[model samples]
Target: MDRPLVAVGSVIFNGDSVLLIRRLHPPNQYKWAIPGGKVELGERLRDAVIRETLEETGLLVEPRTLMGIIEVFKEGYHYVILDFICEKKGGELKASSDAGDAKYFTLNEIRKLNVSSTTLEMLERFWRGEKMPFMITEISK
Candidate 1:
């Protein structure tokens, strides 16, 4: 059986500001989520995260720590996303057509925004250096 997992990163800054995007797809349309995609074959996890962020959000990133891991069951597939806490290296940040728009936000503001439940939980666990386990959670259909 496959591990059914992939590593993901969330670039955050200033203790409260996190990089978010407005997705332009079926899964997360109009919701503010982290600027990351999937881990590519033969690519390093760090490279994948940075590349995905750049491609999706136009921001160069340097992930600092492994925040936590989250398992999501969505759209008839299981995904394990390794959430990384990151900092910006350098880039002129903008939103790609893949993601509607990119911006930074405070913790309170992000909490009020339409963020995915898993994303919010990941941030919460990561903030306290707590560990999360592999478990199933149904996604919004």
Candidate 2:
């Protein structure tokens, strides 16, 4: 793509578990990651996160805090992703849209899954309850 796409992702939490989805699309196809997708033109970041989460995981969530920003570049495509810590509001858990599977996992369970390095770092911060300081990460596939 010519320009970087703006995307939003949510690290939805309920107690000690967090939401994860097995992506059915490229960039991380078949791999587990937080629910999210590209932000539509004129859409707010918070709205994008909520919409993406619902589209991928069938969950309605309320974004609580912004976790951080990640910049990913691979094969001529670039994306600037904003990640948020969200709380479950309502809706059933099921895979939909770009997700092949959607489920909740404890931190220990997440450690054993096939996930992106960026996601791992974000999870670590979330688990520790670290006060994220608007971090910017770059990932190259």
Please give the TM-score that candidate 2 achieves against the real structure: 0.92
Q: Write the per-residue lDDT of candidate 2 for residues 8-41, one digit (tens) a residue.
A: 9998877888889998887777889989999999
Q: Give the TM-score of candidate 1.
A: 0.82
lDDT of 1 at 113: 90
Deviation from native of the Cα of residue 98 in model 1, angstroms:
2.1
What shift in Å separates residue 69 of candidate 1 from its native position after superposition? 0.6
Clashing pairs in 1: none
Residue pairs in collision within model 2:
none
TM per prediction: 0.82, 0.92
